[model samples]
Target: MRHPTPDPPAPGQESVWDYPRPPRVEASDESVEVWVGGVRVASSTRTLRVLETSHPPTYYLPVDDVVPGALRPVDGATWCEFKGEAAYFDLVGGGTSAPRAAWSYPRPSRGFERLVGHVAVMPGAVDRCTVDGEVVVPQAGGFYGGWVTSRVVGPFKGEPGTWGW
Candidate 1:
């Protein structure tokens, strides 16, 4: 399929189209937080942002940063050619539960070992997510876990008719 024209990024912003195909992992010091059911489930100053072509960044927070007992291992798993097998988790807090709302790579592929012990949540499945105090917009498709923030511009892949992109 032909690629869509990328939206030009404004100053201080990045275009998703410019991200690499194999995906890159970079550490972010920006404060990242995740709230579920009105409960703050996770927060961290140290996060790993996964950047891939056509997708917004997916932030992975360290397990130690998550609130105690907030994540419960659940059934189901998925594989990523780049990241390896991912196990799902149910996020429970404030009397609310989000099944399979989070995932982590127990044993990541070589060169992606930094993903170990870090968890990434689907923004759409949680009550809210923020980066440096800015609320994030979840990537459009239900399947992808990218978080959309003002710093990133996209004709993102999860939107309708973008499956091939």
Candidate 2:
């Protein structure tokens, strides 16, 4: 598939097409929050943002910032060539459960070690997710966990017909 033309980023905005290919992990000071089943399960200012070409930023929150007893380990795992193997977690809160709603790399690949001990949740699987107080739109398609906020512009990768991007 031909690369989609990137939308022009307005002032204070970023275009996902400008992100790196292998992906870059950097510290983020933005307030990241996750809610599930009407419960605020996680919130943190000290988070990591993973940026890759054609995808919106995916925020990884420190496990310590999550509410106690909210994440339960689950079976199955997936591998990311850039990050490493990820173990799944069932997010439980407010008497509701979202299976495999979250994941983390227990031992990340070199250069991506910052991902260790940090969790990324699927916004579509949970009730809501926010970045710096703004509700986020989940990246198109259900597989990737990129968080779409007003600060980012995209013809994001997960959209239909973008499989080969």
Candidate 3:
């Protein structure tokens, strides 16, 4: 699957888009703070950024830290050639014992191997999760954004396929 890149915001504007093709998903090995069930989940690792949006920015997290019994798989899904098929999950608990939240590719396309088995949750859904020790808010609904306290550009809003690709 190949998705074309939309034009970058004109020197000073911003655009959000998620298309297929050069799957650009990255992850970190470092442990990040993930608060679910209002308690911090230890060993939760990673920060991922997806390069496109119509809704909000998507953040990725490691499954280790998220409470094991928190997520309940749902039938929801969205598609993009870049990362591949995104299966959604409904948050079971609002971050306490088990916090179920939004997540993506366990089987991302070849280009998006970085996101394999990585889960991205809604910041709005959790009590707190910090990037570099700073708290963050989920950028988009049903998507994920890894503590986007400081970002250089914006095409913000994790809505897929927004900009003209």
TM-scores of the models, in the order given? 0.98, 0.99, 0.61
Report the candidate with higher TM-score, 1 versus 3. 1
Top-down lDDT ranking: 1, 2, 3
Residue 109 displacement (Å), model 1: 1.1
- Cα error, residue 160 of model 3, in Å, equals 15
Q: What is the lDDT of candidate 2?
A: 0.95
Q: Give the alpha carbon lDDT tens digit for every residue of 1-165 in model 2.
A: 789889999999999999998999999999999998899999999999999999999999999999999999999999998888999999999999999999999999999998988999999999999999999999999999999999999889898899999
**How would you encode candidate 1's per-residue C-alpha lDDT over 1-165 as one tens digit per residue?**
889989999999999999998999999999999998899999999999999999999999999999999999998889999999999999988999998999999999997999999999999999999999999999997989999999999899998999988
Q: Point out where model 3 deviates above 4 Å.
A: 1-23, 29-31, 41-43, 46-48, 51-57, 93-100, 140-147, 151-165
Decide which is better by TM-score, 2 or 3.
Answer: 2
lDDT of every predicted structure (CA atoms) = 0.95, 0.95, 0.57
lDDT at position 14, candidate 3: 39
Model 1: lDDT to the true structure: 0.95
Candidates 2 and 3, the one with greater lDDT: 2
Note each model's CA RMSD in angstroms. Answer: 0.7, 0.6, 6.1
- RMSD after Cα superposition, model 3: 6.1
